[model samples]
Target: LLCQILHCLLILLQLVEIVLFIVDSGCSKHMTGNLKLLINFVEKFMGTVKFRNDQIAPILRYGDLVQGAVMIKRVYYVEGLNHNLFSIGQFCDADLEVAFRKSTCFIRDLKGNDLLTGSHGTDLYSITLQDTNCPNLICLMAKATSSQAWLWHRRLSHLNFDTINLLSKNDIVTLHAYFATEGIHHQTSIARTPKQNSVVERH
Candidate 1:
């Protein structure tokens, strides 16, 4: 009964080439991805697999527990196989239940809510899971800002407000002082050229 249900789940699962997994109840371990590529694999064990003609094939045990989105633990590694093998015994060990009908498989959570569903594939059942891409903490933060006073100082073509303030405080560049410094004896009504006053006239 367990094997039938698990087989249905595997047949219905949508998966890509990178994560093709076989649902094998007879297999002891939930075989994971390529052993040589996975960094977390440790504790290698020598396992022997028997085939139809009593042929035995040596297997390597690379056990790992996959949690979060799809929860499975103690998965092995098979070198030559194109797909990983999921063990129904492991699912039973985890106390999870699978239901199948109408060529579809449904995995339920502890509360009896449907966790995942998969449609039947053409040849067999294959499960495909969704992957999420989220931004890290540093990328979500806003950039730092500069002071308004410093911004205005630069916008005025590097005019030094400190020097201007000092001159005004001491009355060094008052109206009379400015006129005398510029060598203008009296105020003259001089008209500025159109091009020179164009920017001021726009406002």
Candidate 2:
């Protein structure tokens, strides 16, 4: 019974960390407590705003948000806010449309495809979101690949053709000799141009 009680407590704590953000059409930007995205900083608040009971809130620039397929750019970090906020204007800026009806709300992309849905909270519709910066997950900008040469192209840290060919010829790696032969010839031909400086070619 004690173990089960402890497990429930852990689950509650995790659920609290994954906060529910209210969809606020009046808000100018997305605001959160501390859950930041991985984007660039914009600017800080010029002054503090007083909430209920004269509680002062200082707004700061937060990072971006990129999930499996969605992206929220330039969020705000509100240290004093306990609840998260999503701005309708920001969503519209990103070409997303929001539909609110009765007690439920839906966020859709430019094509009207559903991206997220939220239920009505105490005063507004809210959706739960996890930050990409969370330690449990890592975000990377990459594309799909199936070719062995293209696969090696990334694994070898984008090394030049001649160096990659040398490694393959000397059996330093398991790469096939002909894998980059054509590409190397094309690269060599391009390198002859004066604009292809040594500094640019090294990479």
Candidate 3:
């Protein structure tokens, strides 16, 4: 009778442990699912507003959904300082012609400072006309020109005018020249090999 009672008690304890483990695991899984759902819901809600301001307005004004799509794509897709500096007005006759005729033009930093001495390069006249949007442009310009060579190199290295698609051949040429002038050249230290030199030479 005593042996049978002890065996029953051991079996009961094992079952209780197994049940508790299962319950804890299930609870954790449930909590994780709930957290993920909440995060997704919040992201969707915020995206709704961004979509209207950045997407819908441009579509209504332009009348061409494709152009609107391109604009939205550029606004979202392009990374770094130069992306925000470009806009629809850039297609206008005055801005477009100036961008083409002057190689040195549009070399100004966001703060309206000339990137090169006036004798060497030109500043974008339209940039001054964009004072209303200055606050945003200022932020981007500051970031790009912050560490002169690095940002300048990055801009030149990945020069994709496809999004705005208005930069002329001259614009590209001038930018390339400016980068060559301002970029830092890193020199590699030469290591001497044993085969090329006397191994037992004394100084």
TM-score of each: 0.45, 0.51, 0.14
Better of 1 and 2 by TM-score: 2
Determine the C-alpha RMSD for candidate 3 after optimal superposition of all C-alphas: 28.7
lDDT of 1 by residue, 32-136 (tens): 546632435666666866555666666666655432365455666655555666666766677777666667766676778775555567744555543222222
Whose lDDT is higher: candidate 1's or candidate 2's? 2
lDDT value, residue 121 of candidate 2:
65
Using TM-score as the measure, what is the rank order of every candidate, best first? 2, 1, 3
Q: Give the C-alpha miss distance for residue 138 in model 3, angstroms.
A: 8.0
Q: Per-residue lDDT of 45-154 in model 3, one digit per residue for the tens?
A: 11111231364211111111111112111111111112112232423312222122343233333455432221112333222111121122111222232345455546
- Measured by lDDT, the strongest candidate is 2
Model 2 clashing residue pairs (backbone)? 37-64, 39-64
Clashes of each: 9, 2, 1
lDDT of the candidates, in the order given:
0.51, 0.63, 0.24
Which portions of model 2 miss their true places by more than 4 Å?
A: 1-17, 35-39, 42-47, 136-203
**Per-model C-alpha RMSD:** 25.7, 18.2, 28.7
* CA error at residue 111 for candidate 2, angstroms: 0.6
